[model samples]
Target: MFEDGQVVPRAVLDSLLCDAAISRYIFGPDSQLINIGRTERIYPDELRRAIIARDTHCQYPGCTAPPRLCEAHHTKHWGRDHGTTDATTGVLLCWHHHIHVHTHDIDITWKTHPTETSTEKHGKRSRKNAPTGHWEFTDRNGNLIQ
Candidate 1:
């Protein structure tokens, strides 16, 4: 199907559906429209805003796209995997990266802050500052992406 005069591929549709307000259309065996209604948003406005604030840029590794160019993506697919639409399960990604992930079957997971220990000259243990959180990206073949 076409949207905004552009051809939308299945991968793009899958990416969009990750964080879109969906509507359901049911059809009958005779090709008659049986029911139509809007469904709950995958990523509501407030949750999406929170994710944007948290990420502030594309979450795809090495990507620098700003939040304005990003879209909220589910770490797990909502349709295929019955993933929950929660802030903890979502990340911001640019349009290109979003489609790339779906097309390439990339998996994303969040890692909490980890303490890094260092030994001082006197053999005392010290903690080093580290990122509050990090994300891991892997391909369908189980290869990690930097």
Candidate 2:
């Protein structure tokens, strides 16, 4: 699903639905949870296209990875009960960096800074927020990269 660059087919979706139904029938209603609302609107095709165009690659600084290996990350996680799902609260990140951003207490700041030419540069930067139990990424030369 990640490599083919194709939308999920209906047959596979049907099979998944059947499996879930069988599980629910055997285990009981509490075994399955259903989401019936506008949550799916957040992952529309246009949003994916916008993510690709805006970020171009992984938004993690110094990472040259492409979009195919990355995911559109929501800065504010979406929940069934929570109401916010705006475009500004999203970023693109590769799998490793995405997990790192969520699992650790990392501070991510999205702002505009002045460039050498005195022009504004807008982007996101990560800083370690925890005193301990924090994750770090380093380059091959044993220097910290993130």
Candidate 3:
């Protein structure tokens, strides 16, 4: 159902529907990304809750802002690039990291391990290579942060 770089994961959508967090939405003829109208929030309330549950701290390598304080950032840049607003497409980042990412020279990539090595035992999504609560942040010159 997805390639490595695709947005709007089927697993996250299934989870949302199965949990009754959000129902079906009707899109208009306009081709613009649908905004659910939560004032300025890009991610939905339920989606945000799901993210907080998975990411207890900032997903950025060394930051430790608690889930609630961290902002749910679209890895693909939601509004500007029409990034999807699902679990696989989103990550929590502290204000500092968030600002730095938006304004600095860094690349945040979701790195998933092979399914055989996945520690998650829940039978639902197979997650095998899902977000896994870790992300790879690299500099413009391709140096991974340690």
lDDT of each: 0.75, 0.49, 0.61
Rank ordering of all candidates by TM-score, starting from the highest: 1, 3, 2
Better of 1 and 2 by lDDT: 1
Candidate 3, residue 8: Cα displacement in angstroms equals 29
Q: TM-score each candidate.
A: 0.67, 0.47, 0.58
Alpha-carbon RMSD of each model: 11.1, 15.4, 14.1
Q: Of 2 and 3, which scores higher on TM-score?
A: 3
- lDDT score at residue 133, model 1, on the 0-100 scale: 83
Best by TM-score: 1
Writing each residue's lDDT as its tens digit, candidate 2 over 59-142 gives 776786898998766554443223233334456778777766555524343455433322334665444433321223444355
The runs of at least 3 residues in candidate 2 whose Cα sits more than 4 Å from the true structure, single-residue gaps closed, are 1-38, 80-83, 114-146
Error of 2 at 74 (Å): 0.7
Compared with the true structure, what per-residue lDDT tens digits does model 1 show for residues 1-146? 67578778766667666756554544457754433223433666666777887888998989999988988787868766766666777899998998899999899999888667666777677778666688889999989999
Show how many residue pairs clash in every candidate, following the order shown.
Answer: 0, 0, 0
Candidate 3 lDDT score relative to the true structure? 0.61
Q: Model 1 scores what on Cα lDDT?
A: 0.75
Which lDDT value does model 3 have at 78? 44
Residue 92, model 3: Cα distance from true site in angstroms? 0.4
